[model samples]
Target: MCTYATVQTTLEGSAKGPEGSWFAVTDATVYFDHPVHALAEHTLNIDFADPAKGPGARVAVELTAAAARDLLSAIQEALDSAPAELTA
Candidate 1:
């Protein structure tokens, strides 16, 4: 349910970024699908999943496409509704 190939960390980096994907497990069920850019097409399967470490793996971004859009909308709405003083 994720894109990319295999998202990993070196125990000394932030698990937060669009390119630097990070997951917690392998068989982790995600609500949305992750687009993996491989070959000449976008794959939606785990080509490199390390279940030994954890079922939750990061193919790419942590948040799915749907989640990112929802969050961005929420933040924009909040900002639009916030007072001018606070924003300034």
Candidate 2:
């Protein structure tokens, strides 16, 4: 089942693309849907991109529900452990 529910946000960061090059990622699009290549039937998909730099300047990820939850927890843990000044 494709939820088609998408969430978009502005981001300030960089990502390494498939071409082995790093690019500034200015936006993120997250959604739950069928993946393009992952083995999972459905996944939580996230695309980090710089639209001004064209389609190639993008990184995509697809994770199963459990994996996505784990990733969220890991992210929170990392942030939580960081020094307040560093995170701020």
Best by TM-score: 2
Off by over 4 Å in 1: 1-61
Taking all chains together, each candidate's TM-score versus the true structure is: 0.32, 0.95
lDDT of each: 0.46, 0.94
- Per-residue C-alpha lDDT of model 1 across residues 1-88, encoded as one tens digit per residue: 2442443333322233234666443332233344544332333332234455553444343454455578779989999899989987
RMSD of candidate 1 to the truth, in angstroms, is: 11.2
Q: After superposition, how far is residue 46 of candidate 1 from its true place, in Å?
A: 20
Residue 63, candidate 2: C-alpha displacement in angstroms: 0.2
Give the local distance difference test score of model 1. Answer: 0.46
The alpha-carbon deviation from the true structure for residue 70 of candidate 2, after best TM-score superposition, in angstroms, is 0.3
